[model samples]
Target: MARGLIKAKMLPEGKEVEFEVEKPVKVSDLLKMAGLSSETAVVIRDGTPLLETDVVKPGERVEIVRVLSGGAKV
Candidate 1:
């Protein structure tokens, strides 16, 4: 991990990316920085799903999982 950067790993693809966070940043904003939508993907930290409003700090680690919809018709 780079010094003073938020590290996040993308699920399925297992691609790792880093973001420079000078201050606390919202999960949704991080998702946007990764070119993803909160509705389409979820941010996870320490194996816990985080809310869009949840704040992530610099030097923190997270994972982004793409949500797949359209399973058995309800």
Candidate 2:
């Protein structure tokens, strides 16, 4: 089976993660492969927000971000 390699970068932290898996996999699967929390992470494929079921193609650059939480620091 063909496979795709993707790299994920964490914003504000500059952390990079690499993932390798079969091609035509869902974004959700990529998240899992990258060891990220699906609920807290927002995914973007090729500069576009992607759905969980969205198919990830080879050589496609993907980004993953963790939702920030902070308001009126107390």
Candidate 3:
């Protein structure tokens, strides 16, 4: 089986992490490989948001932004 590379840019730290996949995998799978939870992080490619069911192609770069939900109740 061939291996594919998925480059991810993590938020807050603005660090880049790379993961290897056997082939094109779903966003959920990619997250699993990266050890990130779907509820806390969102996957984006080409400035567009990707769903859990969306497929991430080989050698693609995506950003993983952590969801921030904090506001004044006022």
TM-score of each: 0.84, 0.73, 0.82
Best by TM-score: 1
Q: Candidate 1's residue-wise lDDT over 4-64, tens digit each?
A: 6899999868999999877888999999988999989999999999999999988889998
State each candidate's clash count. 0, 0, 0
Model 3 poorest 10 in a row by lDDT: 65-74
Tens digit per residue, CA lDDT, model 2, 36-66: 7778887887688888888777666677877
lDDT of 3 at 51: 96
| Model 2 RMSD, rounded to 1 decimal | 2.4
Candidate 3 residue-wise lDDT, 1-74, digit = tens? 37878899987569999987888999998888878899988999999999999998878899988777577777
Backbone clashes in candidate 2 total 0
**What C-alpha lDDT does candidate 1 achieve relative to the native structure?**
0.89
Alpha-carbon runs more than 4 Å astray in model 3: 69-74
lDDT of each: 0.89, 0.74, 0.87
Point out where model 1 deviates above 4 Å: 1-3, 69-74
RMSD for all candidates, in order, please: 3.4, 2.4, 2.3
Pairs that collide, model 1? none
